[model samples]
Every structure is written in structure tokens, then in C-alpha cells.
Target: MRRPSLNDLAAFAAVANHRSFRRAADVMGVSRSALSHAIIGLEGKLGVRLFNRTTRSLSLTQAGATLLARLDPVLQDLDRALDTLSEERGTPSGTLRINANKSGARILLANVVPRFLDLYPDVELDLVSEGRLVDIVEQGFDAGVRLLEAVPQDMVAVKFGGDVRFLAVAAPSYLEGIVPPTTPDDLQAYRCIRQRLPSGKRYRWEFAKRGAEIAVDVPGNLTLDDNDLLVQAAADGRGIAYVPEPFAEPLLKTGQLVTILDDWCPPMPGLALYFPRSRHVASPLRAFIDLLKRWDGAR
Candidate 1:
């Protein structure tokens, strides 16, 4: 067996990281045809199929997955080493990739993006909004933002946003002919707009009463992925929606929607920026963290 060149390995890793030849090529500053040929050449040498390419999607094979797992740490170390050298120049200059959910991304962008960019103009921020909990290290993301409850225990987490609460709300028209739900169990008789997570599971509505917490698997006629849409549907008299307070606040203020179970909704921990504990933090990430800390202190 022959070993692949470092360039070939890096090319393979980029393609695996993005799972799209076009995107990988863009990131590598190469043409799609050229990137494809490089992968083909690497596969010819290894004599293994690394990627399964279909018309609609590209996926990694078993060999590709194993190779990617091995390459992740090496690439991360290389990035950290390069970052260390860049630090000597007294400027953080590199692309920092971040994975976050829709709400988390919104919060981060609203609060820190402008200021962070102003503070460190040399740093590039690549933020991706994903609906599920992802393996940031394995996916080649420098860091991830998530609610404190969703952040993995293995990573170092820094609190950013403040406490958040859920709201059960509906349009006035939708509740005209119905009795409002007083408890979690009462939602069983109500038509709710359910939210589906990225993992394909319908989210259960949660509430707390007295000293006990309950999760209600409420039934619904309309199901969707986005929380904002769910809030809209409820405002349009479709049904009740369980959403974060911030997303539904506008509708509540406009008298389009009214809260039903505010007492049951308790404040929980808000957003946190998290990263792998095993890897050395890059200067770009450290600068962003410092900015976040300052913002938190001021707020």
C-alpha cells in the first residue's frame, strides 16, 4: 500500500467536511472539476470508495468516515499551530467556523457579530445555522452556540444570552369557541401547531406546575420545522403554538396572539458558546470569547 500525499489528504478532508464538491472546491480555492479529479486520484491510490455520490446528495462511506475521524484531530492541530504563529503578528486573522441553531444564530448575530467584526477586522466568521446538536470537532467547526441545556458536558461552555422561557400562545380567533388550557393535560383537547426537530421528532410541550415538571406530547393538525412559522400559524388562527417567548413577543404585543400558560413557563438557562476541550483554542475564537464576556458583563 502507498501513502497519499498531504495535499491529497487535505483535499479529501475538505470534501468530507462539507459533503459537497462545489462547496469544498470553493473553500479550497479550486475548480469543482479539479477538486473532483483530486479525489478521484486519491481514491485510485487508496483503492477504496470514500464518498457515495448521488444526484441529490453526497455521503461518506465507512472508509471515508474512518478517515475523516482520524484526520479531524490532525487538521485541528495544524490550524491551532498556524493560529499560534499568526498570534505573534498580534492580529487574529483566520476563518472561524461556527455551528448554531436558528435562535442561537439570531442571538449571536444580533448581539456580537457587528461588534466582533469591528474589533477584529482581520478575522472572518463563518456561521452556519443547523437545527440539531452536532459534533463540532468532527464537523470541523471552530465552535458552536447552543442553549446551555443542549450544550454537551464534554465541551467548555461560555454563557452568552440571558434566561429564556417558553410560551403557549394562540390568536384570539382560535380561542373564541374554545376554553383556554389551564394545565399541560388540558392541551390534549386543544389543537396545537407542533414543531418538528431536525432529528425528525416532534417536540414535546413542556410545563412546570407547583414543584413538578411535565412534558406533554400534544397532538396537532399542523406540523412545521421553524418556530417563527409556528408562531405565525398560531397568529393566523391555525392553532396554539409552543414557542420561545422572544419569537412570539411581537405577535403578543400586536394582539395577534395571547399567552395561555405563562405561570407554567419558567425561565431557563439561555445561549452559550461551546468548544471542544481537547483542542487548543485559536486566537480568533479567544477574541470572540472575550468580546462575548464583555458584552455579557455590560448587559
Candidate 2:
């Protein structure tokens, strides 16, 4: 049997980790056709099939899974060794992938991302913004940004920004004839612009004040997934929207939206950058975290 090169094994691992030729190729900065051919060549050399391909889905065969289980750690160790060399030279150079929700992404881009990029021009930052929470290790992300409360307990979290508050707001026009909600339960009589979570369930509006807590499965005819959209819908007089304070600040300042049940909403823990406790932190990620801490401190 012919021996496969390091690149071949690395390519196989990339494909196996992502389970998508396109995504793997994108991460490796190679064309899909080239990546596919490399995997084919790798399978031929190894005399075993690595992936079970279909028109709609791609999954690893048992043999492929076995190879990946062993190869992933070796590749990770190799990467750590290479990173160590770069660290010795006092320069961090590599891709740092972060999975973040939209709010967290915006905050980072506005505050931390610029300085981090400027300081380490050799490092590439791949920041993906989405609503869903993903496994950073499984998805090949260097780290993940999410609310501190939502971060997995097993991961090490770096809290930043500050406390965040969710506000229940509505357009003055919508509230003209209706009495504003004095408490969480009063929302039942009003139209709410309900938020649909990434998990495909309606988000229950949570409120707390003076040792009392409530979760309201807000009633509404319209449901939206994105925060910006929900704010817009509320501003357009559709219904009340519960959104992050930042999202509604502009409209609140302009008097387009008025806060209701203000006493019930209090500040909660803010965004955090989290990573797996077990994996070796790469130099680039370590550098990024250092910058994040400094930026948060200076703010």
C-alpha cells in the first residue's frame, strides 16, 4: 500500500470534522474539486472508504470514523507544536475562528476585533454570526461568544462587555389605546412580537424583580427570529418586542418606542468568550483572549 502524505491526512480530517466538502475546502482555502480529489486519492492509498457520500447528506463510514478518532488528536498536537514555535518567535499567526451570536459579533466588531487584527496582521479572524449555539470543538471553532448565562459549564468563560438587559418595548401608537403592562402577567392582554429561538421554539419572555420571577409564553400572531427584525416590527407598531436594550436604544431615544414594565427588567450577565477546557489553547486564540481582556478592562 502507498503511504499518504501529511496533507492527505489533514485534508481527510478536515472533511471528516465538517462532514461537508464545501465547508472543509473553504476552511482549508482549497477548491472543492481539489479537496474531493485529495480525499479520493487518500481513500485509494489507504484501501478503505472514508466517507459515505450522497446527494443530500455526507457521513463518515465506520472506518473513516476510526481513522478520524485517532488522527484528530495527532493533528491537534502537531498544530500545538507548530504554534509553540510561533509563540517562541513572539508572533501569533493562524486562523482564529469564533462562532458568535449576532449581538456578540456586533459588540466584538465594534470594540475588540479591530485592535486584535491590527496587532496581529498575520492572524486571520473568521467570525461567524448565527443564532444557534454550536459546539466549538466539534465545529472547529477556536472559541465561541455567547451570553454568560448560556455558555456551557464545562467550558472556560471570559466575561466581557458588561451586564445586559432585555426590555419590553412598544411603539407609542400601539400603546395609545391600551394600558401598558404593569407586570409580566399583563402582557397576555396585548399583542406581542414574539421571538422565535434558533431551536424552533418560541422564547418565553422572562422577568424578575424584588425576589419574584416569571416566564411568560408571550402571545402574538407574528413571530420573528432576528432581534433587529423584532425591534423593527415593534417600532412599526405591530406589537410589543422584548429585545436587548442596545437594539431598542435608538428608537427609545427618539420616542418611537416606550418601555413597559421597566422595574421587572434588570441587568443580567453579559457576553462571554468561551472555549473547551480540555483542548490546548492556540497562540492566536490566546492572543485574542489577552486583547479581549485588555479591551474589556479599558472600557
Candidate number with greatest lDDT: 2
- Candidate 2 ranges beyond 4 A from true positions: 54-57
Over the stretch 1-299, how does candidate 2's per-residue lDDT look in tens digits?
89999999999998888888988888889999999999999999999999999999999999999999999899989988999999898899989999999999999999989999988999999999999999776677889999999999999999999999999999999999777889999899999999889999999999999989999998899999999999999999999999999999999999999999999999999999999998899999999999999989998
Q: What is the lDDT of residue 273 in candidate 2?
A: 98
Which lDDT values do the candidates have, in the order given? 0.90, 0.94
Q: Give per-residue CA lDDT, model 1, range 1-299, as digits (tens).
A: 57899899999999998888987886677999999999999999999999999999999999999999999889888887888899998889988899998888987789889999998899989999988888886576889998899999999999877899999999999999777998889999999999998899999988987889999999888899998899999999998999998899988999999999889999989989999888789899999999889988999
Residue 51 lDDT (model 2): 94
Which residue pairs come into collision in candidate 2?
none
In model 1, which runs have C-alpha deviations exceeding 4 angstroms?
1-6, 12-33, 39-77
lDDT, model 2, position 157: 99
Taking all chains together, each candidate's TM-score versus the true structure is 0.82, 0.92
